[model samples]
Target chain A: MTDPAVEAAIARVHREEWARVVAALTRRFGDLDIAEEAAAEAFAVAVERWPRDGLPPNPGGWLSTTATRRAIDRIRRESQRMAKHQAALMLHDSTRPDPSGPVEDDRLRLVFTCCHPALSMEARVALTLRLIGGLTVAEIARAFLVQETTMAQRITRAKTKIRAAHIPYRVPSGQDIHERLAGVLAVVYLIFNEGYLASQGKDLLRVDLTEEAIRLGRLLLVLVPEDGEVAGLLALMLLTDARRSARVSATGELVTLQEQDRGAWDRGLIVEGQELVRERVRAVAAGAGPPGRYQLLAAINAVHTVAPSSSDTDWSQVLTLYDRLAALDPSPIVRLNRAVAVAELDGPAVALAQVDRLADGLDAYHALHATRADLLRRLGRSAESRTAYDRAIALAANPAERAYLTRRRDQLRG
Target chain B: MARYLLSVFGPTDPPASGGSSSRSELLQEWADTGAFNDKLQREGHFVFADGLEPASTATTVDGRGERPVFTDGPYLETKEHLGGFWVIEAADLDEALALAAEGSRACRGAVEVRPFNTPESIQALLDS
Candidate 1:
């Protein structure tokens, strides 16, 4: 094999086997730092030897064996210098032999451990991407717009906390799985949101992040097939992602949902997402009267996706679902979304009232100002609308959204 | 198995319970807590647990300098002060957290759980 072919093969296998190999190493070694370093060493060796020796037929198996040996070597080298190396060896006896870490999937155990609540939310997201998603520290740092050293420190601190605090490596038991799963879902959703709208940056959409989040969501579904919210979250992401291309105009301006061409939407993703929405809804109706927040959000997205045009959307259904979501979350963000539905059903004047009530709570949120600007524009309050658009454009980070808002502000009659 | 420190924190300005009925209520609270302590000891999770005196009684002592320094008020001044704490042994963080939850409910205050350092954690620091 040539160098390029070997590199490609190594990259492909690295993406496929990183989490599995690391998880297996962690399960065996009971130490994340060792598992991580050993995996890196194993990959480097593959890069060095695979070109000369030809790619191994069972690359993943070979990588796993090599990484385990590296970890063993690491422990031995360090153990020789320490006085209490015997005790550390016992501590490394694998954090309570899991009754298979629930499904014998090492990847699932790794994901859950990375998303443990003991770590800060940012740390959890960074660690999840690095450890389970197999993203390099530099890539994660770039994705989150943080310095490489900062991200490295964040990951290191989290690993230290996990070991020092004795966070178990196995998935939470039946009694605690639901509560723990919520934390894991929140981290994934945050990554998706960062990709969806993005922070203050030149790029409006982070395709890599949205893709990574969906991948994690799919993995979660396989690990916990019975979890309705897992299905709901995946559905919501897919439904939202279907409109990614139409979200930005060819001329480099943001396209609002009302302006996006529904004809260009991804039919396959829409179908998959709507199917999950149906399953979640049926399960929720049969079991509990109120669905989880993700389920309701997915249902709301289902209504929008089913509509041929924004005007044809079922505003009443969207409003009802938003109301339910507000009851559960009571967040200003939910009310802002609910106000969008109200704008369609009632007059913009009514929606403006709701948005105004949220002023104190969402003063710094760019979407709030954007929504208010649109409401004012619809009400023919040109001066107020112009002011609101200016506020939104100033607060907005995504260059596309800023350009779109800038055009709106300039278009208004003085 | 590991040891954890579950510290109960509450607002510094607790409502002054001076009336006779309030005093009896406090007594009843103490009785309930006493029963909880007994249960912990019976279950082998207890090491030591105690409620703290008011923060006003706390004095500060700093000995890092050549001569030790004594201050009048509590070492740390904050809106919320440590009201009490428990030193309990449990298997892993989940067990410790569960125990802290029950302890928090028993004392009617927020509890913060932290693990005591082990040989590995200390070695990790040295090795790093």
Candidate 2:
């Protein structure tokens, strides 16, 4: 007899593993609701029968198979109820292995669907978190620093938009693929930022979000092996994640790279990231295309990781990469980073000029003002730097960030 | 077997409601979540699930056995009120408790696990 304990265990698995199991099964079944319902039914069966039968050796796979069967049977039943339900049930018997082509194809399709352009950026994020990251509405809301009801509405809206628009759950082709790929890239970026700087919570970083973003980036790389930017993004995330071990202190205080213990960084992830960058750079060199933002960012990180110590950092090369990055993207943030590199490579005076030029665009950005203040103070312009420091303090978001900026301002005054 | 009910309580002060999304979008969310619940059912672990009406309509009753006295307040009056719940069967209290915890995590609400009285218990009461 299946142990009741085991059956209960399977039922719990159904709730936690529902999204993943459904995602994989839906790829086979081709209907969102059907796949979801089927997977749920499989869990229900687990609750009822698994206790008598005992736990299966491969629970996820078993759930997948059971859900798939349930989906087919559901479709058949629906057809009986409604004459309009004319679509054929995409059926594969429970015992057989899924064909590799459709399985692989379905994953790509799911990715495109989750990141579909038809959905707003917020909707895309909510959908991707729900479908791809397998997060519940409450978790997604917590991640976004919003109430659960608000997030639920957002996610529900996104799903409704997809359905009404009849957004096909398939990867785009031709010129459309380019647009969709950008959407995919944007989603990955959003995920990574949330991981890097959690909006709310005691911890500075959310490693789970970081890990999921990396996983998605890697998955994208696999889907489009020739896409240099995808690999670059993966490399960038890897290099950044590599430094996570040193990003916090023993007391959980945030540590800037300059003050970090380099020994704590993950050498394995760094090496892997470096290899990826090397491959992407070589491909870019072969006239595939100009290096994208991810490639440029990865190159900048590569500089930091390749150096044995902070003093060993090749500020000049990093400046050059930032220059290229600015030329390509031309964002206020990129210019601010460039100013920092210029401060190191040139001198505090030259860097101050760059910061002044960026000041107008980044007037409200705390870090930008802080950077300007640092350079001004170093250049013996104490009064001006103090003013800049005051501005930064007003704009600062967190206590640690404020403390760090305040300390610099104090040292300048001293 | 045991069953548990976990309710999610929203704030007592109702939110100043804003305009909802377009009808199509609202429908899609309903369809999507409806689909998700369907998955729950397929797993056979779905005991019972439903979203509740507003807590404002809730009525309270006290006393036992015969027709209990009725009141306007809830059964239990607290700042944080029960919103909704789920029922799941488990072998023992410990297992039931664990599932309840998971339910709490999923719903962000309190989960109370209680066993269903077996038929034997009814017969024992008659004998007594």
Candidate 3:
């Protein structure tokens, strides 16, 4: 029988040390498949032995050493010609004495590998959640709403491509780092979005996914402490996630920012997020570099968090940030969001004109229709508002969002 | 070093027949392609290069069954057909992709790069 303590230890180690163990093995073997297999074997061995004998003093070290040994053995067994040379290299590398244990952040290397631009965006998401987050293929498939076999094939293809393509197993440096960082941040934000507003589900929030994204953000903070953009991303996610409790009404309807109960917001996260935003903004002010898109976004979230109520929100400050954000990234979505702030400051008529300009590009986006509907209602254009509401309700994939839009449309009719 | 195949795909429809302007455009394209191949040779990235005839002229022989079956035309009906390919050696995928990007400009068509797997790497994957 497995001891409860041993089981708990295994679970904890899997959560905390899987990336490190796998990374160490991958570094040694230079193959993601071998590294993962070795790590799995090490965990299996841990389950068998840890219960019999008490847990090791350093579980992570123990796991890494065991997994490394397994990888070496596998490599040795596979190629008789290269066995002696490979075994010698593995033994020499594994036995090196270090006073400071596991000093290098192997997880960071794994993060860069998973987020490499060579792989497709879907592959990056799947690999990040699987390798870094320690989630199962089945779990990842469920999260993406794809067949387990499809996810498994995608992951296998990605690993094979990485090996074949020889995508380096290290954090990028120089100009490449800038491009790769965007991919990394995008993957993290995608995870948070999946949690914050699940693409297709009855519930508004998937706490597990949100918490996982936040955990990743925190981990990224530890790995890249000085990256203002990294801090900005973490702050953005935290500040936005802080309002999770207040984002849905007790009756399970989607609640807009203005209608949400401010008392339900997570004050601790707001404080932490606000502090991070201030530090990053201060760094920008000191001429580290111009504020990135994420930093400006985080600053906007910070402003919203500090406000007593939606009305108390500094529209002028929000407008300024939105203007800067629009300048940096004039994406349709950014302009759409800026229009909301414009509606508050310059009135709905002016905002409606801006929103109308975006109609062609953002025709399929539900938020675009929703924003237009809100502005039209304020302008007393009931017929146009009802039509816009219908479009939003039709386009909205989330059941909660669809329900909320439906209710609004019904109210307009009444 | 790894071997990569840079396959250039061409539109299915035959080239439009027009006057001297169209003929000159084709000549210019061929000249640009010749210059690209010369660059590849100078850089020592060239392994082998070849341009195929139209897919309509191709035949497929399947050996998966007990008896091999011969099929007419290309195996798959695709909008774009493999027009030509280059086998080049590179240290890694990034280098291969960079080379393929240059090849794309030369060929003036879409290029797909795929790596050839070694026996040992295949064994490693199978072992896992």
Candidate 4:
């Protein structure tokens, strides 16, 4: 096989089969370290032989079989009493016909365990990408702009913690499920936000993180179909990502939502997200529980995306959604966003007063300053606007955002 | 399963509740805490739990060198002295944290949980 073709085939198989292979190995071997190492070794073996031998008839099956063999080989290499027991189990399970099920419960267990609150947020993200998302340590490190060794250590330490602490390897039930499901959803959402807006980097977006997060969201939707928040989170990510192209200009300047080209926005994502929101609303009307945080967020984004242009956006409806969101999450950031809608409805003066009131809570937050600068500019207070813009530019981490703020500040009356 | 130290941090010198009703409330808190300890023992999670005297009564002695140095307060002279602690076995950190939450409520003080070092845990870290 040609090199590029073989490489592409391997990449595709790795993405499709990595999680399945890892989950299966973890279940059989009952050791994450063994599972992770064996899975990687199996993939390495594929990389070496695939080009020479061509793609397997069943890539996932081949990988799973190969990983099992590798795990057994590893266990046999060590003389630990525990390793021998695990090796016997793996040997026993490898011969049986694998059962087919509607849901991959092993992966579901892996997801909950990876996102367990006992792990640090950073560790959770790293582990999820590695174990469940099939991202290599190098790939994850590059995406997060960290060293490969550092990412490797983080993942290794997390796996050690899971084993040592005996973090249960199963989907939680009852009240534990509800609370822990929130953690899983939160990890996914955090991944999306990190991708949607690079906190401190040259790039405005990391497409890989966003794509991985969306894939996880979809997986959650399938694994736990009854959870409305899972669907809501997926919808929210889709709607937010739909605006990616319009979020940055050709010259790499960050574009505000009002200034973004509506035609450039992804209509397919918008339609899909809006449809999901409509479905949730219908479900709620049919006596389901009230919409969750993600659901309400998706609804707000739906309203924005549905508009033909910025001027056509229904500010009142946006404000209403914000009101509901505030009741659910009484965070300063939500109030700041709601104030943006208030500016459109009650004028810039009203919004400016509200923004000032949030200073104590959000003084160090660059977006707050950016919003203040904009409202002040709208109110024809150029001096105060310039001062606010200066603070915003100073505090902002993204180069693109600083560029945009600088341009806006320079445009004001000097 | 692993052992965790759930250390409760209370006021160094507890101020007396102003009224007689408040004093009764304190007694009620103690009774509740006693029940909680009983529940822990029943569940087989209890190892040892006890309250300590106020920080003012602490006496520390340092004999690291040949000439020993005596200190008046805690070993390190810190503000975060443990008011009480419970050493319990749990499946994982989640179980430990959950128990700590209950312990905090029962004692009406903040609780911190730390896993004890085990041979497996140390080996796992070294392997990593």
Candidate 5:
């Protein structure tokens, strides 16, 4: 018999409180494996007992306490085999002298751990998804775009490194904070990138990853409230998320902004995003520092969202923001986006000139070809446009992109 | 809350062959360490502790299901094999870090601290 009560409790444990509990227990139990085992034991107990006895008022707290006790017991049992086990007992004894107060913030500690610089970028993403995102190895593997076995090994190796190096579990301070903060942002950005454009799969977007990234951004904002850049990043994500609904048609076809139904855009998200951006800008202007890449991106997005129609978009403002963004973070991708704004504000010829100046490395890039084709077609260069469209079609990876490119080719021929 | 895993690694180089007296002294020190572990168990903070054999004895298995390929090597090809580990719970990273120091002293080797994944994180990924 499938017990609804037990199932519901498990769902609650997994959804609403598991990370908090695990973090709290992990704070007490220094070892990841032991902490995991103890937390599992607590969950097992909850499965067996929660149904019989009503769920505790604070299930998370109960789980944390239970897991802590189990960890202590496990430590005691293992003490017999090694010389250092005695010291382990001593440390355990000293720490548990008082358990009356509420459990400290384990989630914050977890974030710092996930963002540990000792781990590689891949390891950091994998570990963050594993520990902070609470994903299974198989799920992480899928998100990682790799084999499950490979991901599992990566995770295990990462854990071994943690065990071997004895990486501390706390938020860094002073100068160390800046370096660690970058690691933290990188993981958050990685999650957002995956959501913004899934590298594989049929879909262009993964809303779940996007939403999760936003959630983590929100959490980061809470943890580091004074950081205008963090606020800026949140605003940027919100603005991007606001456009998700209009990004595609009901049939899952890609819908460019000019063609999208402006009415379908989420007004609430746009408003929230605008306020966040405005607040961050004001804060930065007041003396926090210069606006960051995220702030600039948000400013550009705000221009788009504030406009009543596609034609009403403040191209000048977008161009200005793009210029600032490019200056702040010079990248080929940023230049590509800037070219679009230049095309609108100036002319196809100017945009084409700008594109030509870009490095030859982008010759194989689909977006480069796509943009060239669009510009060429607008200039009435049909044969050149068709050739560019063909190149785009060849370089395009996603089905929607291929279809879009093919459609452009047909239009050029017509 | 903070969590850390403290581990002590055995030296890569084996103890040099020596006369009986030096060997006896090393064995005595090893025995003292064993009793120290028993004291740790009674205190109730130990998660798991195991002494691994030399790196040469390690066998790694890769792949999954039907054909898990077995290879004769440690998971990490490095000389630093995991000799033993203990998971300790602490109130914060500082506290967990302090325990790591103590762990090193007890085992006569280095100790590492790390946090575990929480279930919330697992669901967060699922939600993503």
Candidate 6:
């Protein structure tokens, strides 16, 4: 039987040091598969040995050394069996630390590698969750609603491609850093969105995915603290997630922002998110680089959190931020979101005009029709509002959203 | 270390009269090409490098059927053709790309770098 103390210590190491240990091993071995496998074997050994030998003061170091030894043994065995000179050379390299350690954080290099643009977007997410997030293939598969076999195959294919293509296991430098950072941020936000508004499920939210994304966001901040966008992304997720409890009614019906009880919002998250936004904005004002899209979005969320109630929301400020966002990224979704702020600040007529302009582009987007429905209802065009609601209900995939739209449509008919 | 094939592609037609080059310009181009080849050789990265004849003189062979077959010209009908190539050794893709950039500057044409797949790399993929 495993000792309870050892179990707890192993769990803690799995949670905190998995990525670090895997990263250090990966750098040393120059192979992700070996690194991850060795790390797992080391953890397995720890579960058995830590119970008997007592926990080491430097658990990460112990784990790294153990994993390295396992990797060396495997490499040597493989080389001897296959007579592969390259494998033997790699084994020799792995046994010695480089005189010059990595200049940048190894975890950051691992993150960049996991999110490399060479891989498909889905592969990038899976790889990041598996490698950096320390999620098992089964867990990632479950989160993505795919078979365990499919996720495993995807991860293996990605790793194989990384090896075959010789994708550098290093953080990109100069202009490439900004471009690559976008990819990393995009993966994190995509994970957060999957959690915030699940694409398909009976439940409206996946708290575990959300927490995981926030954890990654925090990790990125530590890895690249100078990046204002990273801080902004973490803040955006925090402020957006602060209303998790208030986002749904008791019966699991979707609660619109205006209907949610502001008192139910997590004040701690709001305070923390607001502080981050303020710091980023202050830094920008002091001649730091201008706020990126995520930073601007966080600023918008900060505006919403500062309001005591929905009606008291600073609409003009929100509208201005939306305009800025629309300028930065003129996607139909951004314009659709901007229309809502327009409705609040500039009345239904103006907002309806903006929404109508987006009709052709956002025809398939459920939120576009929903926003139109709300604007029409506000303008007392009950029949038009009902029609818009019908479109929205048909397009919406989430049960909560569909039910909410159905209720609204029924009220209009009445 | 890995071996990369740096394939250079260029248009079949020479420069037009409006883009005429002077004698000095031709000499400078030759000088640059020589310097690039020398650098690769000096660095012990050069395995083989050579320019190719135009595609018009090339022949195509297809043997998917029972008997062999032959075609008149290059396989693909494209404006640009493979003009030359260099096989060089490099530590990794980054070095390969950097070397390709120098080759591109030397040749004044697009250079594509592709790593050679050896048995060891294939084995590594399977092991991974």
Evaluation by DockQ, superior candidate among 1 and 3: 1
* Residue runs of model 6 more than 4 Å from their true location after superposition: A1-9, A48-54, A81-103, B1-66, B69-114, B123-128
lDDT of 2: 0.73
Chain B TM (all candidates): 0.91, 0.58, 0.88, 0.88, 0.74, 0.85
| Candidates arranged by TM-score, highest first | 1, 4, 3, 6, 5, 2
Candidate 2: list runs displaced more than 4 Å. A1-24, A27-30, A40-60, A72-104, A200-202, B1-128
Q: Chain A TM-scores, all candidates?
A: 0.92, 0.85, 0.91, 0.94, 0.88, 0.94
Poorest lDDT segment (10 consecutive residues) of candidate 1 chain A: A80-89
- lDDT tens digits, residues A27-69, model 3? 7766788888899889889888889987899999999999988
Greater-lDDT candidate between 3 and 4: 4
Each candidate: what lDDT?
0.88, 0.73, 0.86, 0.88, 0.75, 0.88
Off by over 4 Å in 1: A1-6, A81-102, A285-290, B11-15, B20-25, B63-67
Q: All candidates' TM-scores? A: 0.91, 0.67, 0.88, 0.91, 0.71, 0.82
Best-performing candidate as measured by DockQ:
1
lDDT (10s digit) by residue, model 2, range A158-268: 765444334566567666677668779889988888878764565678887888788778767877877788998999999999999788767655677888899999999
**Candidate 3 accuracy as TM-score:** 0.88
Spell out the clash pairs found in candidate 6: none
Q: List the residue pairs that clash in candidate 4.
A: none
What are the per-residue Cα lDDT tens digits for candidate 5 across A277-343?
8898788778878887777888888999998888899999899889889897888879988999999
Better DockQ candidate (2, 3): 3
Would candidate 4 be rated incorrect, acceptable, medium or high by CAPRI criteria? acceptable
lDDT of 4 by residue, A346-372 (tens): 999999999999999999999999999
iRMSD (1 decimal) for each model: 2.2, 21.4, 3.2, 3.2, 11.4, 2.7
lDDT string for model 6 (A1-414, tens) is 677877888888887888998888887777898889998899889888888999999998999899988987887788633466455447646655466974567899899999987689999999898889888999999888889999999999899877766777887878779988998999999999999999987888989899999999999999999999999999999999999999988887899988889999999999999999999988998999778899989999999989999899999999889888888899889888888888888899899998999999889999999999999998999989999999999999999989888988898843
Model 5 misplaced regions, further than 4 Å:
A1-16, A44-52, A76-104, B1-128
Candidate 3 at residue A251, lDDT? 78
- Superposed on the true interface residues, model 2 gives a C-alpha RMSD in angstroms of 21.4
